[model samples]
Target: MCSLEKRGDVFILTITGDSDHRLNPELLDSITAAVAQVKSESTPSTALITTAQGKFFSNGYDQAWALSDPARPKIISKKLRLLVEDLISLPMPTIAAVNGHASAAGFILALSHDYLLMRRDRGYLYMSELDIGYPIPRWFVQLVRSKIGSPKIWRSVVMAAAKITAEMGVEWGIVDSAHNGIEATVEAAVKLGADLVGRKWGGEVYAANRRVVFADVLAVLGSDETVGDSGDADVASVMNHKL
Candidate 1:
C-alpha cells in the first residue's frame, strides 16, 4: 500500500491506494515505521516527502476496517491520531504533496506536516470532516490558525461545517505553496526543502518560532479540541448537512 524511496538522504514516502490506493492498517503501520526509521537513521540535511502513488494521497481510514470491526473504531482512530501527532513533531523537515482529495482524518494528517504543497488546479484537496459526522478537533483548527488567523475563516472551516477549497487554501496560507499539478508542487517543495536544509539548527528555528505564533491556538486545543475527544460540542461535533 505504501513504498519508501530514498534518494541520497531524502525519503519520499508514497502511499498507494489499497487495490485503488485504499487504506489498510498494516500498510499504515509500515508507513509509520518507515518514518520512524528515517528519523532515527537519517542524518542532517535530510528531508521527507509524504505523497501518493495513485491519484490521491489517501482516503482516510479504510471503510472496510470500520465496517468489519465496529467495536475497534475508537482504538483505531486514537492510534492514528497519535501517530499523526508524532509525524508533526518529527525532528526532520516534512512536506505534504496533496495530490488529491484529503478528507476526514487525511486532512488532520496533512496538517501535521511542516510544508503543504498541492495540485491546486486539479481540484485535489477537500476537508470532509463535517460530512462524516466527525467533530472539529482543536489540532485541526490550530493548524488553520497557524497558517491563517483567528477569525470567521477559521470558524467557517471548523464550526460552520465548510470545505476549504484550493484557492481559499492559497489565500488562507495553510498551504505553503500551490501549483498547477502534483509535479509542479513536488518541484516547488523540493526547492523549498533545499532552501531549508543545511541551515543552522536543522529547521528547528522555524519550528520554535511557530510556538510563539500558535500560543493561543495550542491552549485552545489542550481543552476543547483534544485528540481523544472523538466527538463532542466543545471540541468536536458531528454533522451531515452541507455548510
Candidate 2:
C-alpha cells in the first residue's frame, strides 16, 4: 500500500498493506503511481515521510507468494530492490516515519533513509529472513554498516533475525529518534530535515561529502539482489518459528 500527499514543502509517502499485512497488489499500478507522483511533484529540497497505513509497515512479501511459488520471491524482491535503491538515490531527503514494525526487506527499506523516526508503541522490528533460512543481501549488511560499525552486530541481525525495540533502535543508531508517538516523531523528522537543508551553504560541498562517503563503497555493492534466494525449505523453516 502506498499513497503520496503534499505537505507544504514536503511529501508524505505512506506504505499501504492488505489485511494480512502484505503489499496490496490486487490492483495494478496503484503504488507505482504514488511513487511517480512524489518524484514528479516534490522539489529536490523537499523531505519524504515513509510511514504505513496500518500497524505494520509491510511484511515485505505476501506469505502466500513467498511460501508457495519459489519464483515469486525472486520476482518481487527484484522489484522491491529497485524501488529501495531509487529511494536511496533520490536527490531529496527521505525520512522513515516508522509507524510500526518493518522487518526483512522492510527493515532495510527504513534504514536507507537520511533520517529515521519511529513511534514507541509500534510493532516489533524483526528480520524474518534468517528464521526462514534466507541469507540477506550484502547491501543490507552495508546499510547496517553505515549506521553500526560492527559486522558482528549485523551478522546477528542477519543470522538470528533479531527483533529490536524502538528505543533500542535509537540507541543503536538504527533510527535517528524514537518518540513516544508518530505525530510528534513526524514533526521532529521534518524539523531535523529542514534544519539540515537550511544550514547547507553550497550544494557542492555537501555533494562532495556525500560522494566521498558513498563513492568508495558503491563499487563494493553489487546488484541489489545479489544475495542468494530462499527456497521452499527456507520459507518453511521460517514459518515454523515463534517469530
lDDT of 2 by residue, 68-162 (tens): 55444555555665565556555566688877878776776677666778888876677776776655666666667775666676666667677
Query: Across residues 1-243, which tens digit of lDDT does each residue of candidate 1 receive?
Result: 577777655678887653434445676677788788777766656778888755666656565654444343444455565566556556667888877767656766677677888877654445566655665556566666675565876666666646666677777766777788778877777777666665634535554655455555445543433324454332222222221
Model 2 residue runs over 4 Å out of place are: 17-32, 200-212, 215-243
**Predicted structure with the largest TM-score when compared to the true one:** 2
Query: What's model 1's lDDT at 190?
Result: 72
RMSD of each: 4.5, 3.9
Name the lDDT of candidate 1: 0.63
Error of 2 at 203 (Å): 7.8
Worst 10-residue lDDT window, candidate 2: 20-29
Residue 236, model 2: Cα distance from true site in angstroms: 9.6
Q: What is the lDDT of candidate 2?
A: 0.63
